[model samples]
Target: MPKNKMKSGTFIAMCVVTVLFIVMPLFLQVSVIRNAIAWILSGLRYQEYKSAYLGLVGGLLGSWLAITGAIYTQRKFDREKEEKRAIEEKRAKEIDKENIKEICREMLWSEIRQNDNSLSCDNGNFIKAIMEKNDCYFYNRDSHRITTDNWNFIIDKVISMDLELAIKLMHLYKYYEFMTDFDGSADSAFTKSQLDFSKYKECYQDVVEYLEFPWAND
Candidate 1:
Protein backbone atom coordinates (compact mmCIF):
# COMPACT_ATOMS: atom_id res chain seq x y z
CA MET A 1 0.00 0.00 0.00
CA PRO A 2 0.99 3.66 -0.39
CA LYS A 3 2.62 5.34 2.61
CA ASN A 4 -0.31 7.72 3.22
CA LYS A 5 -2.80 4.88 2.97
CA MET A 6 -0.72 2.79 5.40
CA LYS A 7 -0.59 5.72 7.85
CA SER A 8 -4.38 6.24 7.57
CA GLY A 9 -4.98 2.50 8.16
CA THR A 10 -2.76 2.54 11.27
CA PHE A 11 -4.64 5.59 12.65
CA ILE A 12 -8.01 3.90 12.07
CA ALA A 13 -6.83 0.72 13.87
CA MET A 14 -5.68 2.80 16.87
CA CYS A 15 -9.08 4.59 17.02
CA VAL A 16 -10.85 1.19 17.01
CA VAL A 17 -8.57 -0.12 19.79
CA THR A 18 -9.16 3.02 21.95
CA VAL A 19 -12.97 2.73 21.53
CA LEU A 20 -12.90 -0.96 22.57
CA PHE A 21 -10.49 -0.60 25.51
CA ILE A 22 -11.63 2.77 27.01
CA VAL A 23 -15.31 2.99 26.02
CA MET A 24 -16.07 -0.68 26.71
CA PRO A 25 -15.16 -0.32 30.39
CA LEU A 26 -17.15 2.92 30.71
CA PHE A 27 -20.18 1.15 29.21
CA LEU A 28 -19.90 -1.61 31.86
CA GLN A 29 -20.72 1.05 34.53
CA VAL A 30 -24.00 1.72 32.70
CA SER A 31 -27.07 -0.62 32.87
CA VAL A 32 -26.13 -2.11 29.51
CA ILE A 33 -22.91 -2.23 27.42
CA ARG A 34 -25.04 -1.60 24.32
CA ASN A 35 -25.79 2.04 25.38
CA ALA A 36 -22.05 2.72 25.96
CA ILE A 37 -21.22 1.19 22.54
CA ALA A 38 -23.91 3.41 20.92
CA TRP A 39 -22.45 6.52 22.59
CA ILE A 40 -18.90 5.62 21.38
CA LEU A 41 -20.20 5.06 17.86
CA SER A 42 -21.86 8.51 17.86
CA GLY A 43 -18.52 10.13 18.90
CA LEU A 44 -16.70 8.33 16.03
CA ARG A 45 -19.32 9.65 13.57
CA TYR A 46 -18.76 13.23 14.82
CA GLN A 47 -14.97 12.86 14.40
CA GLU A 48 -15.45 11.67 10.79
CA TYR A 49 -17.71 14.70 10.09
CA LYS A 50 -15.03 17.08 11.45
CA SER A 51 -12.32 15.45 9.25
CA ALA A 52 -14.53 15.91 6.13
CA TYR A 53 -15.09 19.61 6.90
CA LEU A 54 -11.37 20.28 7.43
CA GLY A 55 -10.50 18.47 4.15
CA LEU A 56 -13.03 20.62 2.22
CA VAL A 57 -11.59 23.85 3.62
CA GLY A 58 -8.01 22.83 2.79
CA GLY A 59 -8.98 21.86 -0.82
CA LEU A 60 -10.73 25.21 -1.38
CA LEU A 61 -7.71 27.19 -0.13
CA GLY A 62 -5.33 25.22 -2.38
CA SER A 63 -7.54 25.84 -5.45
CA TRP A 64 -7.65 29.58 -4.76
CA LEU A 65 -3.83 29.79 -4.55
CA ALA A 66 -3.43 27.93 -7.84
CA ILE A 67 -5.87 30.32 -9.62
CA THR A 68 -4.09 33.39 -8.30
CA GLY A 69 -0.69 32.10 -9.43
CA ALA A 70 -1.99 31.36 -12.94
CA ILE A 71 -3.41 34.87 -13.38
CA TYR A 72 -0.11 36.49 -12.34
CA THR A 73 1.90 34.32 -14.75
CA GLN A 74 -0.42 35.13 -17.68
CA ARG A 75 -0.18 38.88 -17.09
CA LYS A 76 3.62 38.76 -16.95
CA PHE A 77 3.81 36.88 -20.25
CA ASP A 78 1.50 39.42 -21.98
CA ARG A 79 3.68 42.35 -20.85
CA GLU A 80 6.82 40.73 -22.24
CA LYS A 81 5.10 40.00 -25.55
CA GLU A 82 4.02 43.62 -25.95
CA GLU A 83 7.52 44.88 -25.24
CA LYS A 84 9.00 42.61 -27.90
CA ARG A 85 6.46 43.81 -30.51
CA ALA A 86 7.33 47.46 -29.86
CA ILE A 87 11.04 46.79 -30.29
CA GLU A 88 10.44 45.00 -33.59
CA GLU A 89 8.35 47.89 -34.97
CA LYS A 90 11.08 50.40 -34.08
CA ARG A 91 13.72 48.29 -35.84
CA ALA A 92 11.55 48.07 -38.97
CA LYS A 93 11.26 51.86 -39.21
CA GLU A 94 15.04 52.27 -38.97
CA ILE A 95 15.55 49.77 -41.80
CA ASP A 96 13.02 51.63 -43.96
CA LYS A 97 14.88 54.91 -43.46
CA GLU A 98 18.16 53.34 -44.56
CA ASN A 99 16.55 51.90 -47.68
CA ILE A 100 15.05 55.26 -48.67
CA LYS A 101 18.44 56.92 -48.28
CA GLU A 102 20.09 54.34 -50.53
CA ILE A 103 17.51 54.79 -53.31
CA CYS A 104 17.79 58.57 -53.17
CA ARG A 105 21.60 58.34 -53.49
CA GLU A 106 21.37 56.20 -56.65
CA MET A 107 18.91 58.61 -58.33
CA LEU A 108 21.17 61.64 -57.73
CA TRP A 109 24.18 59.94 -59.42
CA SER A 110 22.22 58.96 -62.53
CA GLU A 111 21.04 62.51 -63.09
CA ILE A 112 24.65 63.79 -63.00
CA ARG A 113 25.87 61.18 -65.53
CA GLN A 114 23.14 61.48 -68.17
CA ASN A 115 22.90 65.25 -68.02
CA ASP A 116 23.44 67.03 -71.39
CA ASN A 117 23.42 70.84 -71.81
CA SER A 118 21.63 70.39 -75.19
CA LEU A 119 18.59 68.86 -73.38
CA SER A 120 18.37 71.64 -70.75
CA CYS A 121 15.35 73.28 -72.35
CA ASP A 122 13.78 69.88 -72.95
CA ASN A 123 14.32 69.05 -69.30
CA GLY A 124 12.78 72.40 -68.34
CA ASN A 125 9.73 71.67 -70.55
CA PHE A 126 9.32 68.23 -69.00
CA ILE A 127 9.53 69.69 -65.48
CA LYS A 128 6.94 72.31 -66.48
CA ALA A 129 4.58 69.57 -67.68
CA ILE A 130 4.94 67.75 -64.36
CA MET A 131 4.21 70.97 -62.43
CA GLU A 132 1.10 71.65 -64.54
CA LYS A 133 -0.13 68.10 -64.00
CA ASN A 134 0.28 68.51 -60.23
CA ASP A 135 -1.24 72.03 -60.39
CA CYS A 136 1.80 73.69 -58.76
CA TYR A 137 1.37 77.46 -59.29
CA PHE A 138 4.34 79.60 -58.09
CA TYR A 139 2.53 83.01 -57.89
CA ASN A 140 -0.59 81.86 -56.09
CA ARG A 141 -0.11 80.04 -52.78
CA ASP A 142 -3.48 78.30 -53.09
CA SER A 143 -2.93 77.40 -56.77
CA HIS A 144 -1.82 73.84 -57.46
CA ARG A 145 1.08 74.15 -59.95
CA ILE A 146 4.06 71.85 -59.27
CA THR A 147 5.56 72.17 -62.78
CA THR A 148 8.37 70.29 -64.50
CA ASP A 149 9.85 73.73 -65.43
CA ASN A 150 10.74 74.56 -61.82
CA TRP A 151 12.40 71.18 -61.30
CA ASN A 152 14.37 71.66 -64.53
CA PHE A 153 15.56 75.05 -63.31
CA ILE A 154 16.79 73.57 -60.05
CA ILE A 155 18.40 70.66 -61.90
CA ASP A 156 20.15 72.91 -64.47
CA LYS A 157 21.51 75.25 -61.79
CA VAL A 158 22.76 72.38 -59.66
CA ILE A 159 24.43 70.80 -62.71
CA SER A 160 26.14 74.06 -63.79
CA MET A 161 27.47 75.50 -60.51
CA ASP A 162 25.95 73.34 -57.76
CA LEU A 163 22.77 74.19 -55.69
CA GLU A 164 23.56 77.84 -54.64
CA LEU A 165 21.42 79.42 -57.32
CA ALA A 166 18.84 76.65 -56.92
CA ILE A 167 18.64 77.35 -53.18
CA LYS A 168 18.07 81.10 -53.78
CA LEU A 169 15.43 80.30 -56.44
CA MET A 170 13.86 77.72 -54.15
CA HIS A 171 13.40 80.37 -51.39
CA LEU A 172 11.95 82.75 -53.99
CA TYR A 173 9.46 80.21 -55.42
CA LYS A 174 8.10 78.36 -52.38
CA TYR A 175 10.48 75.40 -52.82
CA TYR A 176 9.47 74.05 -49.43
CA GLU A 177 5.91 73.50 -50.61
CA PHE A 178 7.15 71.96 -53.87
CA MET A 179 9.34 69.55 -51.93
CA THR A 180 6.40 68.62 -49.71
CA ASP A 181 4.45 67.30 -52.70
CA PHE A 182 7.57 65.59 -54.14
CA ASP A 183 8.26 63.89 -50.84
CA GLY A 184 4.64 62.83 -50.59
CA SER A 185 5.22 60.52 -53.60
CA ALA A 186 3.23 62.90 -55.83
CA ASP A 187 6.07 62.83 -58.41
CA SER A 188 7.04 59.23 -57.93
CA ALA A 189 7.48 58.65 -61.67
CA PHE A 190 9.77 61.68 -62.24
CA THR A 191 11.74 60.94 -59.08
CA LYS A 192 12.29 57.33 -60.12
CA SER A 193 13.20 58.06 -63.77
CA GLN A 194 14.40 61.66 -64.35
CA LEU A 195 15.86 62.75 -61.01
CA ASP A 196 18.60 60.12 -61.11
CA PHE A 197 21.45 60.31 -58.54
CA SER A 198 24.14 57.70 -59.35
CA LYS A 199 27.10 59.27 -57.48
CA TYR A 200 25.47 59.09 -54.09
CA LYS A 201 27.95 60.71 -51.66
CA GLU A 202 29.29 63.16 -54.26
CA CYS A 203 25.85 64.44 -55.20
CA TYR A 204 24.93 64.68 -51.51
CA GLN A 205 28.17 66.59 -50.87
CA ASP A 206 27.37 69.00 -53.71
CA VAL A 207 24.02 69.77 -52.11
CA VAL A 208 25.57 70.14 -48.66
CA GLU A 209 28.38 72.39 -49.98
CA TYR A 210 26.13 74.62 -52.05
CA LEU A 211 22.47 74.39 -50.99
CA GLU A 212 20.97 75.65 -47.73
CA PHE A 213 18.06 73.20 -47.74
CA PRO A 214 16.18 71.44 -44.95
CA TRP A 215 16.34 67.97 -46.56
CA ALA A 216 20.14 68.19 -46.34
CA ASN A 217 19.81 67.57 -42.62
CA ASP A 218 18.19 64.22 -43.35
Candidate 2:
Protein backbone atom coordinates (compact mmCIF):
# COMPACT_ATOMS: atom_id res chain seq x y z
CA MET A 1 0.00 0.00 0.00
CA PRO A 2 1.04 3.59 -0.49
CA LYS A 3 2.42 5.59 2.45
CA ASN A 4 -0.41 8.11 2.14
CA LYS A 5 -3.09 5.45 1.97
CA MET A 6 -1.95 3.85 5.21
CA LYS A 7 -1.63 7.23 6.92
CA SER A 8 -5.29 7.99 6.22
CA GLY A 9 -6.30 5.58 9.01
CA THR A 10 -4.33 7.68 11.49
CA PHE A 11 -6.00 10.80 10.18
CA ILE A 12 -9.42 9.23 10.61
CA ALA A 13 -8.61 8.26 14.19
CA MET A 14 -7.61 11.85 14.95
CA CYS A 15 -10.94 13.09 13.60
CA VAL A 16 -12.81 10.66 15.83
CA VAL A 17 -10.82 11.80 18.87
CA THR A 18 -11.49 15.45 18.09
CA VAL A 19 -15.22 14.82 17.78
CA LEU A 20 -15.38 12.83 21.03
CA PHE A 21 -13.47 15.45 22.99
CA ILE A 22 -15.86 18.11 21.75
CA VAL A 23 -19.10 16.16 22.16
CA MET A 24 -18.24 14.20 25.33
CA PRO A 25 -18.22 17.44 27.35
CA LEU A 26 -21.88 17.94 26.44
CA PHE A 27 -22.77 14.59 27.98
CA LEU A 28 -21.77 15.86 31.44
CA GLN A 29 -25.41 16.97 31.71
CA VAL A 30 -26.59 13.36 32.30
CA SER A 31 -27.82 12.83 35.88
CA VAL A 32 -25.79 9.58 36.35
CA ILE A 33 -22.44 11.20 35.42
CA ARG A 34 -23.28 14.28 37.50
CA ASN A 35 -24.05 12.08 40.55
CA ALA A 36 -20.77 10.20 40.11
CA ILE A 37 -18.78 13.44 39.95
CA ALA A 38 -20.50 14.86 43.02
CA TRP A 39 -19.91 11.65 44.99
CA ILE A 40 -16.17 11.75 44.13
CA LEU A 41 -15.72 15.38 45.17
CA SER A 42 -17.88 15.04 48.41
CA GLY A 43 -14.87 13.96 50.56
CA LEU A 44 -12.70 16.93 49.44
CA ARG A 45 -11.93 19.60 52.14
CA TYR A 46 -14.58 22.13 51.12
CA GLN A 47 -16.99 24.12 53.34
CA GLU A 48 -19.99 22.19 51.95
CA TYR A 49 -21.04 19.55 49.41
CA LYS A 50 -22.29 22.28 46.99
CA SER A 51 -18.91 24.09 47.18
CA ALA A 52 -16.99 20.87 46.56
CA TYR A 53 -19.32 20.06 43.60
CA LEU A 54 -18.70 23.42 41.95
CA GLY A 55 -14.91 23.04 42.48
CA LEU A 56 -14.97 19.57 40.86
CA VAL A 57 -16.96 20.80 37.81
CA GLY A 58 -14.60 23.74 37.33
CA GLY A 59 -11.54 21.44 37.48
CA LEU A 60 -13.08 19.05 34.91
CA LEU A 61 -13.88 21.94 32.59
CA GLY A 62 -10.31 23.25 32.83
CA SER A 63 -8.89 19.77 32.14
CA TRP A 64 -11.09 19.33 29.05
CA LEU A 65 -10.04 22.71 27.66
CA ALA A 66 -6.38 21.85 28.18
CA ILE A 67 -6.76 18.50 26.38
CA THR A 68 -8.51 20.05 23.40
CA GLY A 69 -5.92 22.82 23.20
CA ALA A 70 -3.09 20.27 23.17
CA ILE A 71 -4.73 18.28 20.35
CA TYR A 72 -5.21 21.42 18.27
CA THR A 73 -1.57 22.43 18.68
CA GLN A 74 -0.33 18.94 17.72
CA ARG A 75 -2.44 18.88 14.57
CA LYS A 76 -1.18 22.30 13.58
CA PHE A 77 2.43 21.18 14.07
CA ASP A 78 1.90 18.12 11.90
CA ARG A 79 0.40 20.23 9.12
CA GLU A 80 3.31 22.71 9.10
CA LYS A 81 5.86 19.87 9.07
CA GLU A 82 4.22 18.23 6.06
CA GLU A 83 4.10 21.55 4.18
CA LYS A 84 7.79 22.21 4.84
CA ARG A 85 8.76 18.73 3.65
CA ALA A 86 6.78 19.17 0.45
CA ILE A 87 8.46 22.48 -0.28
CA GLU A 88 11.93 20.99 0.27
CA GLU A 89 11.22 18.09 -2.12
CA LYS A 90 10.07 20.52 -4.81
CA ARG A 91 13.20 22.65 -4.47
CA ALA A 92 15.47 19.60 -4.75
CA LYS A 93 13.74 18.49 -7.95
CA GLU A 94 14.14 21.95 -9.50
CA ILE A 95 17.85 22.02 -8.66
CA ASP A 96 18.40 18.62 -10.29
CA LYS A 97 16.59 19.73 -13.43
CA GLU A 98 18.75 22.85 -13.64
CA ASN A 99 21.92 20.76 -13.37
CA ILE A 100 20.79 18.50 -16.21
CA LYS A 101 19.79 21.49 -18.37
CA GLU A 102 23.18 23.10 -17.91
CA ILE A 103 24.91 19.88 -18.97
CA CYS A 104 22.77 19.52 -22.12
CA ARG A 105 23.51 23.13 -23.02
CA GLU A 106 27.24 22.41 -22.87
CA MET A 107 26.87 19.26 -25.01
CA LEU A 108 24.86 21.14 -27.64
CA TRP A 109 27.56 23.81 -27.82
CA SER A 110 30.25 21.14 -28.31
CA GLU A 111 28.65 20.15 -31.61
CA ILE A 112 28.32 23.76 -32.80
CA ARG A 113 31.76 24.87 -31.56
CA GLN A 114 33.55 23.68 -34.70
CA ASN A 115 31.42 25.71 -37.10
CA ASP A 116 30.77 28.88 -35.13
CA ASN A 117 33.93 30.15 -33.47
CA SER A 118 31.62 32.64 -31.77
CA LEU A 119 30.24 29.65 -29.82
CA SER A 120 33.01 30.62 -27.41
CA CYS A 121 32.27 32.19 -23.98
CA ASP A 122 32.23 35.79 -25.33
CA ASN A 123 29.02 34.94 -27.25
CA GLY A 124 26.04 34.65 -24.87
CA ASN A 125 23.34 34.09 -27.53
CA PHE A 126 23.88 30.33 -27.78
CA ILE A 127 22.34 29.82 -24.34
CA LYS A 128 19.26 31.82 -25.26
CA ALA A 129 18.90 29.81 -28.46
CA ILE A 130 18.99 26.60 -26.47
CA MET A 131 16.34 27.86 -24.00
CA GLU A 132 14.05 28.84 -26.90
CA LYS A 133 14.20 25.23 -28.08
CA ASN A 134 13.90 23.16 -24.87
CA ASP A 135 13.42 23.37 -21.11
CA CYS A 136 14.75 19.98 -19.98
CA TYR A 137 18.11 20.48 -18.29
CA PHE A 138 19.80 17.13 -17.74
CA TYR A 139 23.09 16.96 -15.88
CA ASN A 140 26.10 15.53 -17.69
CA ARG A 141 29.81 15.79 -16.92
CA ASP A 142 33.01 13.72 -17.14
CA SER A 143 33.77 13.41 -13.42
CA HIS A 144 32.02 13.40 -10.06
CA ARG A 145 29.19 15.53 -11.41
CA ILE A 146 28.25 12.82 -13.93
CA THR A 147 25.70 10.35 -12.63
CA THR A 148 23.77 7.41 -14.06
CA ASP A 149 20.58 8.70 -12.40
CA ASN A 150 20.20 11.77 -14.61
CA TRP A 151 21.81 10.08 -17.62
CA ASN A 152 19.36 7.20 -17.51
CA PHE A 153 16.45 9.56 -17.02
CA ILE A 154 17.42 11.59 -20.07
CA ILE A 155 18.00 8.42 -22.10
CA ASP A 156 14.50 7.20 -21.30
CA LYS A 157 13.03 10.61 -22.16
CA VAL A 158 14.86 10.73 -25.49
CA ILE A 159 13.98 7.13 -26.33
CA SER A 160 10.32 7.93 -25.92
CA MET A 161 10.60 10.86 -28.36
CA ASP A 162 13.65 9.98 -30.53
CA LEU A 163 14.99 6.43 -30.43
CA GLU A 164 17.96 7.24 -32.66
CA LEU A 165 19.12 10.00 -30.32
CA ALA A 166 18.92 7.69 -27.33
CA ILE A 167 21.09 5.11 -29.09
CA LYS A 168 23.65 7.77 -29.92
CA LEU A 169 23.87 8.84 -26.29
CA MET A 170 24.36 5.22 -25.18
CA HIS A 171 27.46 4.87 -27.40
CA LEU A 172 28.78 8.36 -26.61
CA TYR A 173 28.59 7.70 -22.87
CA LYS A 174 31.17 4.89 -23.29
CA TYR A 175 33.77 7.39 -24.59
CA TYR A 176 32.67 10.22 -22.32
CA GLU A 177 33.32 7.95 -19.33
CA PHE A 178 36.87 7.31 -20.54
CA MET A 179 37.69 10.97 -21.19
CA THR A 180 37.02 11.74 -17.58
CA ASP A 181 40.29 10.01 -16.69
CA PHE A 182 42.64 10.68 -19.63
CA ASP A 183 45.49 11.45 -17.22
CA GLY A 184 45.61 7.79 -16.13
CA SER A 185 45.32 6.41 -19.70
CA ALA A 186 47.82 8.79 -21.40
CA ASP A 187 50.34 5.91 -21.64
CA SER A 188 48.04 3.00 -22.56
CA ALA A 189 49.68 0.10 -24.42
CA PHE A 190 48.07 0.15 -27.92
CA THR A 191 46.80 2.72 -30.44
CA LYS A 192 43.02 2.63 -30.63
CA SER A 193 41.10 3.07 -33.90
CA GLN A 194 40.76 6.70 -35.10
CA LEU A 195 37.47 8.23 -36.21
CA ASP A 196 35.94 11.71 -36.65
CA PHE A 197 33.61 12.67 -33.76
CA SER A 198 31.89 15.43 -35.79
CA LYS A 199 28.84 13.35 -36.68
CA TYR A 200 28.46 12.14 -33.11
CA LYS A 201 28.75 15.67 -31.69
CA GLU A 202 26.06 16.90 -34.05
CA CYS A 203 23.80 14.16 -32.77
CA TYR A 204 24.27 15.57 -29.27
CA GLN A 205 22.89 18.88 -30.53
CA ASP A 206 19.87 17.07 -31.95
CA VAL A 207 19.33 15.36 -28.61
CA VAL A 208 19.29 18.72 -26.86
CA GLU A 209 16.90 20.23 -29.39
CA TYR A 210 14.46 17.36 -29.07
CA LEU A 211 14.55 17.34 -25.28
CA GLU A 212 13.96 21.10 -25.02
CA PHE A 213 10.41 20.69 -26.28
CA PRO A 214 9.61 16.99 -26.34
CA TRP A 215 5.90 17.62 -25.72
CA ALA A 216 5.75 19.50 -29.03
CA ASN A 217 6.05 16.13 -30.76
CA ASP A 218 2.82 15.05 -29.10
Top-TM-score candidate index:
2
* Predicted structure 2: lDDT: 0.48
Candidate 2 lDDT tens digits, 33-91: 86886676677766686676665765766665566556666766888899999999889
Runs in model 2 with CA error above 4 Å?
1-54, 111-172, 175-218
Against the true structure, what is each candidate's TM-score?
A: 0.32, 0.35
Q: What shift in Å separates residue 28 of candidate 2 from its native position after superposition?
A: 8.8
TM-score of 1: 0.32
**Global local distance difference test of model 1:** 0.44
- State residue 142's C-alpha deviation in candidate 1, in Å: 24
Model 1 CA deviation exceeding 4 Å by range: 1-45, 108-218
Task: Score each candidate by Cα lDDT.
Answer: 0.44, 0.48
**lDDT at 153 for candidate 1?**
42
Model 1, backbone clash pairs (residues 3+ apart or across chains), number? 26
The worst-scoring run of ten residues by lDDT in candidate 1 lies at 112-121
Residue-level lDDT for 88 in candidate 1: 100
Please report, as a residue range, the 10-residue window in candidate 2 with the lowest summed lDDT.
Answer: 184-193
